[model samples]
Target: PFTPVEHDTTQEVYTLLHSMSHALVSTASDQCGLATESISEMIMPAIPAIVLYAKSAEHFALGGMATLFETRIHPWVDHTIDYTEQCLLDPPCSRDETGAACHACLHLNTVSCESMNEYLDRRRLVGGYDSTPFWDI
Candidate 1:
């Protein structure tokens, strides 16, 4: 069986060094434009250094809802696995699941999980999937 592992300072140093290597990668990042904000969750693109950020005090996007949930505007999430499962359980989705999968932000603008799944499919068409997901939480 796989043994549980703990992260220590020495291990952290290695992790940093490894990240510096060419083989390491970065996921979707929305630091585009100028504003600076924290990211909680995102579906990473195949390209490196792609992280999606939440809305700034200035501007926002249609995907704003998802970002908000990631940052958890008020208190933190209740830490339930059900919520996470709900995000990936979109029904009647497409077969071409090559791109970004669904990211279960607490407030993804979608009215339902099904919609969120479809959105992820759309992202796949536009941005190819990356092995490393952009998880800001």
Candidate 2:
């Protein structure tokens, strides 16, 4: 069950960025050896910034995450953007009328998200149908 909220243009932009953060976290987990659950995202839609970080239950956080951020963050962002430019679930996802986010792309572990993975649409990330991507503006 999900709570309903007023959807507006600004929230739509946050969704787009939040979708990108998910893509980055997925890619980072695969390429950087960090577990998907360890990676978390904080999206400040006011500043329009998505900050990705990692957590560990053990003391002395593993340095892999920091190293990845320093050496690979830029390329990771590039890859995420390229990946989001188009989705395998396009058309329907692109249409955006359905509020189109699914497990295949945008969904994340509930513990890793602030919004419980709601309000996301990759179409907004890349500009599809009637929405202009936040990046272009």
Return the TM-score for each candidate structure. 0.21, 0.78
Q: How do the residues 1-137 of candidate 2 rate in per-residue lDDT, one tens digit apiece? A: 33444658667667777887888887787557888888888887778789887777553235777777779878877777777676577666666575667776778899998789887877666676677775566
Q: Candidate 2 — what's its lDDT?
A: 0.74
State the lDDT at 15 in candidate 1.
26
lDDT of 1 by residue, 23-83 (tens): 1111112212222223323322223222333444434542554554466433322222222
List ranges where model 2 is wrong by over 4 Å: 1-9, 57-62, 134-137
Q: RMSD, each candidate, Å?
A: 15.0, 3.0
Give every collision pair in model 1: 26-49, 27-50, 28-50, 28-51, 29-50, 29-51, 30-51
Q: Candidate 1 — which residues are off by over 4 angstroms?
A: 1-44, 48-50, 58-82, 87-107, 110-137
